[model samples]
Target: MPADQELDQELDQELDQELDQELDQELDQDPTGGYRPLVVVLLSPLAFALVFASWTIFAVLGVELKALLGFGEAHFAVLLAMPMAIGGLAALPMAALAQRIGGRRVMIACLLLICPFLWGLSHASDYHHLLLAGAGLGLGAGSLAAGLVYVSGLCPRRHAGLALGLYGAGMVGAGLSYLLLPLISQAYGWRTAPLLYLLPVLLVAALLWLFAEDREAEPDVPDPLQESPPRSPPAALLRRLACWRLWRLALVYSFFYGTFVALALWLPAYLSAQYRLPLREAALAALPFTLAVGVGQVVGGALADARDFRALRWWVSAFVLVCLFLLSYPPFVMQVQGVHGVIALHYDAPLWGFLLLLSLMGAAMGVGKGSLMRLIHRDHRDEMALVGGLALTLGGLFAALLPLVFAVGNEWVGIRTAGFMFLYASLIACMLVMVWDHASDRGARA
Candidate 1:
């Protein structure tokens, strides 16, 4: 291994070069506009981040609730998943409404919508009460689409990927639960922990109302004569929904984003169980993966903006495959006959190495999230609200379902690393689809 001085020198040189390049570039500007686009991208994401925090709060809160209420594992898992499930259900309706009323209005309403749920959560005395609060809180998931439409609307078409990435980075706010929940739950009480969210939610709603610009609610109405008059409204919608390519893109997004969220809730417990780390320590340990994902979104989006991303997708997926292959190995002792004697072998990932691999996997997924979103917008800018809504909906449902899958894998497979193996297999299936898609494209070209 290199000495400390050599590593430090190399790190310092890299940092200096990055800083120098940033300095040489002029001040940051919004796409095709002045500071307004920047304000939209930044402020809306800030609002989204606050709302996003609630989506994962139940995971933190459910541990205590499950015991207090004396529930089984399945019920507890359902409680943890309620927000995402309901939110996914709500996204399409909310997106349709946003397309009518404007994303700014929908965003403000979604932010305000979380306030009452926080109050209810603080007051919840029964499992049903908590479930109701959680379901209501799930409505805030619709804000992902609102934030997407809001941020991308202000920027020019070319910059849509970076804007979406910035908005998606708001997911980092889900980490807030890991930071503040345990402390507040300890200092006050679990009941009072939800109260801490009330003030900020209200404040963000008001700020969005006063400051954010409103895009025209909908695209210009098409002349009736331009369409086939015999087609019914439902038929028109069915045709729109029949796009297989759109479905594929949405499914791809669902896996990346869904996996990010699933791991966010799962890793804390996984780390605690596998390595026998303390619960709080495991939560803290997970911060690197979340942080890398947040930062990587921007880096990936910017790269997509600058060049072709078709090949990048393959390379990144391959990298994740390698990481997951390493992660999927369960701790075991193996024996084999050697030339001289029987040999014994033991294998288990050290905590640091596992965390390092998680960070790498998270980064690659974030890049994929960014670049693929850019591709979606590049092709479907006119229908962004609808397409983005479909993506968010699928992602939320995917996140909601994965915990059960993980639990099933653990129980039936009788392996601690079963979750990773499941992810590895699922990702391989997704990659195979990508390969098929690429081959088809090449054949079509020929």
Candidate 2:
């Protein structure tokens, strides 16, 4: 039978099985709760957090790495971009690899493999060793995208929003790094900072492996709606890339991911340099921004579930506007007034402004993040591989540029240029989203 017919048959079988399960549960005298949804949701985050904590080691330790290794600003920028660059390259294969192994199994393997590299990195005597270790860390961390898919699959459709939101909260590891890693570095020095994370890493992995069940696989299952894999489709591939609706959704994801990652890697360094705060103090300032981002993910996930795509567009647009305003506020404040204006505002004005910007941006991006995934599901359900892969690839590519942009901006335009870049990016993103919203409406009406 053709692939589409096979798919239809599979769906029928799946539906039948689900019905049988439901009926069996109804007949049972006691419907003992197996794994509570709350347990699954909470465990997923804790597992995810361990991975993310390792994912952000370099970002948290950026300043220390620069000092210890005597790296130039440009080299530091390269170090910053490396993980995301590798993650983009690794995502597709990791997704496929997850299918071959299993997401939960692969995720556990990655955690085990990735955590040791953090220790190696802490001990790196030279740049070459650190770069190689970073590559290992990068490849290992790509398992996370696969883990997201796993989490999405585990939940029923009705609860996907809350489930994913819970998963995203694991990003609090980024915040946790800023809050804790710096203190570790201060108390124990940079050499031992990464090692300290080992305790949590081991604990979380052991817990997850014990609690998380493997997702069942059905190899002979048919997907009736799926077209047969094309032997030659060069032109089709090109057209798919150019699909207008797909591009619009990709744009949102790129910004949402790019914003989240850029900060995850750069915020600690930014705080330390701009404010001349000690590593520990800087971490505290950066903590709220990261935590706010985690909060934003939950908020965004909730909103995406409740609202229409049009409402989501407006919400995202408003979010970008807020980010832009927050980014530009300090400069705007300075321009309208003078040096005395700075004094009146006090020395901490820029820091406060940055925190505010980060809070708004993080939450906005979180909401946009889930909505982006939903948009892909809605628009290109059949062609998810091409669309999701390209969106993630592009997001990673853009993310690759951010550290360099910050480094160069600091070199040429002054340290404040980092804020200006955020401001500019936010402005353009807002404009494009508004335009896309209009385009979508026109297309729908037509």
Candidate 3:
């Protein structure tokens, strides 16, 4: 061969190797993809659990922190909601960050940085120190956005719903940590809980960095612009946010996720105040609620996989409406002490009935959480980043308010009806969104 031809052949070989590597990445993305390493997927959640568990530590320790910091209920609510608020607000930026630095790198960075800050949270002498510490923790935990984006890229389209549900199970770690950390705090004081929490993050971060590989780019995906397409500058990102599906999904997540987040933060306080339950007892009672959420995610994923989009969407929406109705109304069964033994009789109360309904709202959220993203991804392939980021932000923002709203309500409405009103409104809004979505789909078909 001539010298020029030889050089051209050499360059072609290098390009071939690059293409092979890229293909390997796409393969790894599928659940059964060769790159879909079982060990990493199983263990990544352990790291995620640590990050998430730390996110809600304040909620479980709110009373203790309130007394120690000499803060009021409103302040305590603000403190508990701060991490979520920051996490919500920062999700989009973090998603972009993941693309820039790679997901593993960002996650590891946050994991390490947050540990010392968590230690700071344990020993803060004043509000400024606490606020700074909360910011660090929130930024660190917000890495969940990056991880979800990373995982979504890796999982096969067929199994993405299931994988997402399993990944979401990481939230259960928050509940477990809440149950355990307070007990540890009771013995050692609230100051030590955040410090001890650092160990899990450090270990998980190390395992992730060692095991997780960089996700490959999808070069073969059909380009929107056929020829030379100008990359949209970051400044135009807000314009791309015009995808209506993003708002629809965000609305769905806002209600379901809002309920989950709010209930998780407020339930411990509610049980403690309303039932005079001990701290440990209140935490234990809240476990049932969290368990329901975890279960709902799995069930929702399965239902989505099995059903058609029309059926899946309506069923999920209707379930949410029913849950809201349950939240708005509850049938109470009473145990009357009689001559022989306590005989149980059922009575309906608009109050306790609503609380029970609030609990059922998880089932509806579970349906949406598990399945809705699949449909979104299917329809809005090009806008996944925008959709996911906004959906999470909406969810987080709505959730962030539950504790604050409850606190304000307790102060104003004589304690009994305050929280329920917000819960009622949130559920109603969620139900309305679902109903509107169903109606819209029907009209579009017509």
TM-scores for all candidates: the values are 0.87, 0.80, 0.81
Top candidate when judged by lDDT against the true structure: 1
lDDT of 1 by residue, 1-446 (tens): 23653565456446545643552342243232455566788787787778777766776655667768887556666776788788888887687677778888898888888888899888888889988998998899777678787776666545666888888888788688778887788788888888878888888778777766675454667687876555775686578889777776777777888888878877776786788876567777888898889888888888877655757777878888998899999899999999999999999889999999999999999998888888677656677777888898988898788777777766667786877887788889988888888678667756
Best by TM-score: 1
Q: How would you encode candidate 3's per-residue C-alpha lDDT over 239-354 as one tens digit per residue?
A: 57764556876677666666777677777777777667777777776776676677777677655544434346556666665554444332357798999999999745443444
Predictions: Cα RMSD each: 8.6, 6.6, 9.8
lDDT of 2 at 42: 67
**Pairs of residues clashing in candidate 3:** 28-35, 29-154, 326-357, 327-354, 327-357, 327-358, 329-353, 330-353
- Lowest lDDT sum, 10 consecutive residues, model 2, at 328-337
* lDDT tens digits by residue: candidate 2, 1-446: 44654575466446545754763464353333356334457666876676667667788787778877798777887887887788778765565556556667777777787777888988899988877777777775555666665666555444455567667678788777777777787788877877877887677678767777655564756678879764355666677667666676666677667667766777777778877887667777777777777777787666555543435756666766666655643333222456666333323356776777777777777777766665564345444445665666667767777888888877776755464456466658656776777677667756
TM-score of 3: 0.81
> Model-by-model lDDT, in order?
0.77, 0.67, 0.68
What are the clashing pairs of model 1?
Answer: none
How many pairs of residues in model 2 come into backbone collision? 8
Worst 10 residues of 1 by lDDT: 23-32
| Arranged by lDDT, best first | 1, 3, 2
